[model samples]
Target: MPHDHEHPHSLLPPEPALRVKALETILTQKRLVDPAALDEIIDIYETKIGPRNGAHVVAKAWMDPDFKAALLADATAVVSELGYYGRQGEHMVAVENTDDVHNMVVCTLCSCYPWPLLGIPPTWYKSDAYRARSVREPRKVLADFGVELPVDTAVRVWDSTAEVRYLVIPQRPAGTDGMDEAALMALITRDSMIGTGLAIAP
Candidate 1:
């Protein structure tokens, strides 16, 4: 008998939020995880701790040129000055996006990320597809993520290793010179630090 019934499995999301839900479901079904605990961790990453810390870092860097210079020179120390360091983010690197260069990050081996700053890494980031293709076809992958760079803009992909992870300092959007730190923080997002999206405009 040709069975048309689809096997029961957690339906994953096409976007970030629901993807976490799906990952949790899969782990729970395997009896390898606790849903409540997972939910709590996810909440902390999404709201209280993760992305907010990265936003502060990016906002401060944008506002102060000297700090920006220091950040680029020694990312680990500069990020530490902001007090963002933890399990998956012990070593940090900041890559700036300018008119001539677009920076992206990926862990080819696994889902190594700077969670202390950016929060729970996105589902797409941890996926095998992204790990494999981000290095080989970065331009195509960036296009899929909706970031289209200019033809002459050089794309640099930073491979996240066990010793170090990267944070992409997305180019500050135009017309935001007058915005304060709080306002600038609001413009930054999880994906912007991950190099898959841009900061919001004022």
Candidate 2:
């Protein structure tokens, strides 16, 4: 004879926020360091310390037609082509921005970013204000970022979920007729991919 038995599934309960708060309280009580310093350190690490690999990828795509085709077809390979492949960006897709269609990226569920190319996402990108406001008012958000699109331009927003990530390949600016690769790279800023700023003309 057999008897019905139940086992507790939640052997270890989930208390991520509570644990974090407890650790934070302990640190604060100990006067380990200023809380604001953590933010500054993080900012410095992401911007100054980390690799600016995304700019390199963007510049490469702009300069090499074959590389651009490879990048658009398979971003991971293209990124690896320049020896900058990694965890989040093991997969990538290069979306081209056209005259009539503009591209923007957002991660609604979490800040799943393409770290291999873009490096660490900007602070504003991971902010709750940006997450909530982006989907609600995309055009307005773009406007707030000083990106004025033509009235006829259709804004296409890509939500970066768990599996997929995207990067925008802005159209090369006019007057770069004879600019070389190094010169072209100077025009590729992170803001350009986000559609907040157009590439500077050479």
Candidate 3:
């Protein structure tokens, strides 16, 4: 006779968030990590350093033609001068979205994201489903993200690697000519820099 019951662990959903929580618990129990310190760090990245940094870059590009040109030509060097160069962001390439084309970035092999600009990569970006589908059917992926481009607009996919990463510069929205850099930054979202969404219209 065999037992009909599944293992208790099997009852848990195969979600990465659950696994991360479990690991954190274990580390905390072992006194290897301080929850308070971890929370503070996460807060800093989420509120101060994450998407805001990328938005600053994007807004500067939108307001300064020379900066935009330099960013598109040599992203690593240009961003470095702005104090954005580090670790996973050691090398970057900025791809501008024009009327005829759009650009998106993904790391199929793993989540090789630009941490300095984007902070932590979103869970979906590291998922196997996104990693596979994004390359095979990018237009569909964009549509799923609620971004509908003109039929004539071309979608370009960039694969981030250990040595190089990409930042997508979404087109500047209309009615933004009078806005300053800080105001422009307010319109830029993390997904916009990832090319899954557009800048918010004023």
Whole-model lDDT values for every prediction: 0.86, 0.77, 0.89
98-166: candidate 1 lDDT, tens digit per residue: 989888889998788888888777889999989999999998998897888889989888887667889
Cα lDDT of model 2 by residue, 99-202, tens digit: 99988888988898777677777888899977887777888988787778889988888888766778888889888877877788788878777665677766
Comparing candidate 1 with candidate 2, which one achieves the higher TM-score? 1
Query: Between which residue pairs do clashes occur in model 3?
Result: none
Q: What TM-scores do the predictions have?
A: 0.77, 0.74, 0.80
> Candidate 3 — which residues are off by over 4 angstroms?
1-44
Candidate 2 local Cα displacement, residue 56, angstroms? 1.7
TM-score of 3: 0.80
lDDT of 2 at 182: 75
For every candidate, C-alpha RMSD to the true structure in Å: 6.6, 8.2, 4.7
Model 1 pairs whose backbones collide: none
The count of residue-pair clashes in candidate 2 stands at 1
